[model samples]
Target: MSDDANRHDPAPNLVLGDADGGRLAENIMHFARVLRTAGLPVGPGKVLDAIDAVSQVGVASRRDFYWTLHAVFVNRRDQREVFDQAFHFFWRNPNLLERMMGMLLPAMRGEEAPEDKPELSPRVAEALAGEREPERPQEQEEEEIELDAALSVTDREVLAEKDFEKMTKDELDRARQAIKRMRLPIKPVKTRRYRADPGGRRADLRATLRASARQGGDLIWLKKRSRRRENPPLVVLCDISGSMDRYARMLLHFLHALTNDRDRVHSFLFGTRLTNITRHLRDRDPDAAIDKVTAAVEDWAGGTRIGESLHRFNADWSRRVLSQGPVVLLITDGLDREGAAGLEVEMERLHKSCRRLIWLNPLLRYDGYAPKTAGARAMIPHVDEFRPVHNLDSLAKLADTLSRSESAATGEMVRWKKLAA
Candidate 1:
């Protein structure tokens, strides 16, 4: 064959027996890359696992190969969605590049659905469709099956666009799973006396005297050191109103982590009423604890009655949880649909009862936020510090603030006072 003919022929590089194997291996690698881009955490281990799974299953049929790799690589529920989307787009039999290109158009319009379903561009889709499918009965059946399930395509696209607001029951469940996996670095506050070493410090006089007495009352040197325990009680009041539904659920996971890690973390959730969930959060497993809390809370995603809730907390829970200069985390948006009278009184009481009352508001995530609302106005001055709690970054800041001795007071309170003029 002439050089031109050899170059034009697609099978020139293919060895007779290994032609199919080579193509399957190449496609698997490419599909793995797609899964990685779609946020499936497809690392070298998963890649190796995919290859082994494909080899064991035998690459004779496309459906077997697709499912074999999927069973090995897609572990988590959220990851399964991304993997399924990427797998369909990447392994298309005809007009793959065109389909991918259609997917990319939505992204360019700044309306790309959530990171749940990563789609490709039209140009890219056209490029991928370069290879034609072999005419086989099984291949035709697979194609027909896929076409019948086209409804899933629009569903994924909708999920991507809706973000958190449009999450389905299953998606919300997966989100909660994601939240559980998140690790919050909550350091314990150590007391001054706790740092002293029993052996190196002044001495344990009582122990030394006891030791000398065992020696038949001989003149023996004795040393003594006083010991004080370090236990910084954690007090958390989480808001569970409609406005804080998303944030409150996630925060509950964090609080569960905190409760299990520490000895004295008191947790309470409130919407229309106060419900102490310290015991519930203390359950060893976060999922079980959250389930227990869900069962206990009568007002999940209910109307906000912050004033009323806070008043109840101050009246009943404050004395029990606020002893030992406990650090207070007041998690709320401060958007009391009810009037601020009860909130103001409760805030004042809470501030006095705790060592520091740090207010965490999701509303503060916006840059131009002002405490113009009645609840914000009533509660701002009473809080030792005000901070945002909308995202992971904000939660990290909260961890830092909690670990430290002093609270980082923001000027939003000052801004609010001026605005009230």
Candidate 2:
């Protein structure tokens, strides 16, 4: 290799502690912390690795630095956008330091800054904002304690109805906490298996004879058996496409709670492909579970291919998860990229396979919502229940609905279809 080629080729591993290496390493550490705050799952070990990688490469060029950190920090495709945004704001922008300095001054509190910052996602915004704990006077603290207790109740009521898209970072945290406390109060479905019941309607002749034998043929006692009742499995097919991203994360928290509360709960996430994350959600810690899911899923925040995804589910997963008349919760907006091709067939099959098929669309939160899309129209006819899954109130309603013995009627579907037409 020529001398010019050697300069461009670069060394295999970055050497540490160059002239400006210490300052660069500090910036890298801070940047890693920022990413961790924004929900990227960046750890201290990753931070050190990133520093070392950058040290070897030398951040003489901006592109080289960006790619170096991106390779080290971004683990999932969904995190790419967030990482890019944070990178530009943290390093590339010359005015970010000026803005930070401006924010610290007491006089700048009411004054509008000359430059406006780009809006970040709720998670990112929350991480970058960081936590603040200020000292309070004893008298003021007591007043706040009394006020906070009353405010918490009122706040919960308000949060129940608040839309996921409209919620602030603090509100989102409260919503997650609320969802974690939620439980599904579903009625058990009777199975083919029989269990001995003293007052059962069906008499078991063999058991009756055995009872008589026990009594030495002197007396007879009728023995009865009843169908065993157990909580049916729950299968959730959630859409994690770009459009459903905000609602999906909240719903995952809800799913984690449900998984811990019940038995035989299966979860599959789909964007352009289907991924079974049932094992991932079984983690005891919500953060750890979500992190596992983020690392395991490949097509997160991608485009929607609803028809294809459903077709894949029906063909591959229906037999395994849809046994014993399990209740299916289909969560998506029903916007198919292929114009609802083959959706009707797959939906009909899914409806027949499961005892109850519930379509939970966040769009239904709107008062005048209708099944306007082709995908929505095809799916509306097959679902036993059509409900909104946007807020805590909606989820509570869903839990109540499932607990009831009676499922939703076909009339509701007719009304929706007519409205769509």
Rate residue 310 of model 1 by lDDT: 84
Count of clashes, each model: 15, 1
Best candidate, lDDT-wise? 2
TM per model? 0.56, 0.77
For residues 185-262, could you state the per-residue lDDT of candidate 2 as single tens digits? 889989998999998999988999998999999999989999999999999999999889889999999999999999
Q: TM-score of model 2 relative to the true fold?
A: 0.77
Off-target runs (Cα >4 Å) in candidate 2 are 1-32, 43-72, 84-120, 131-151, 166-174, 285-288, 407-411
The alpha-carbon deviation from the true structure for residue 207 of candidate 2, after best TM-score superposition, in angstroms, is: 1.8
Q: Kindly list the per-residue Cα lDDT of model 1 for residues 57-108, writing each as its tens digit.
A: 7755555555677787776433444555555566544344444555556554
Model 1, position 89, has a per-residue lDDT of: 60
Clashing pairs in 2: 14-56
Each model's lDDT: 0.67, 0.80
